[model samples]
Target: MAKPQIYDVLHREHEEVSELFHQLEEAKGAEALELFARLKQKLVPHSRAEEAVVYPRLLEESNTADTTREGIEEHKQVDKLLAELDAMTPDNEVWQAKIKVLADMVGHHVDEEEGELFPRAKQVVSDQEAEQLVDEYARERDSFVEDIRLEQRDAAE
Candidate 1:
């Protein structure tokens, strides 16, 4: 089998998060909170894994450095938004507004990653390096997700 490209792996995650955000926007009360938890669970790890496996490589390339730095900063902003949502109940007056803002912010981030970052990354790495990065990204992300799942499970219990 051909090794999966980093673009496809990241894009699949983007779609999953986008779908969760859609579900979250339509949900109310506890359901919204539940959806938000899932989004946080998925997103935090995905961003971390990208930073671990993707960003550093791009940061090393003068051609890709600025965009990679911007993407990293955007991830930090997204982290803050996730934290703010986590602190509030879904029924809070501002919860819905915050969710909309997060969705828009994420949508913009995805556009930049897909349109600019990925194309530039493609130029910076060889086909072999791209494939290797996909493997590394998947492993790193899955490990983080499992750790988060255990924490959530322990908290619930």
Candidate 2:
């Protein structure tokens, strides 16, 4: 099957995350925890894929490099927030507020990626190259997810 464009793939992930955040906000108890876990699973790999597979191309253009650089720093902030979220229980008094902050951070990141970065990236990267990157990013993201699953499985055992 023909892979999607890089923007399409990443944009779809962004949508999923947005939905997850809404669901997370509504949930409580173990359900909230499970939803958060799922969000983390999608998030970490998605960010890593963009960093490894997409950022280099975005960085090639001076116009887009600053935007991409900021996006990378934003990703780091999200990771740090995710780690903090991971360490807290669902019922903790600060938990919901933290989730909101994470969601806001992700929302900002997605807005910039879809609005600013994707347009400039399309100008810099060819349709064929973007198509190729979709596959590479999918592979990279899948590998990261599997590695995380393995680590969790091992920890459980």
TM-score of each: 0.96, 0.97
Q: What do the candidate models score in CA lDDT, each in turn?
A: 0.93, 0.93
Candidate 2: clashing pairs of residues: none
Candidate 2, after superposition: displacement of residue 114 in Å? 0.3
Report the number of clashing residue pairs per model. 0, 0
lDDT of 2 by residue, 83-145 (tens): 998899899999999999999999999999999989988888889999999889999999999
lDDT of 1 by residue, 1-157 (tens): 8888888899999999999999999999988988998898899999999999899999999888999999999999999998998899988999999999999999999999999988988887988998889889999999999999999889999
In Å, residue 18's CA in model 1 sits off its true spot by 0.8
Q: Of the candidates shown, which would achieve the greatest TM-score relative to the real structure?
A: 2
Candidate 1 TM-score over all chains jointly = 0.96
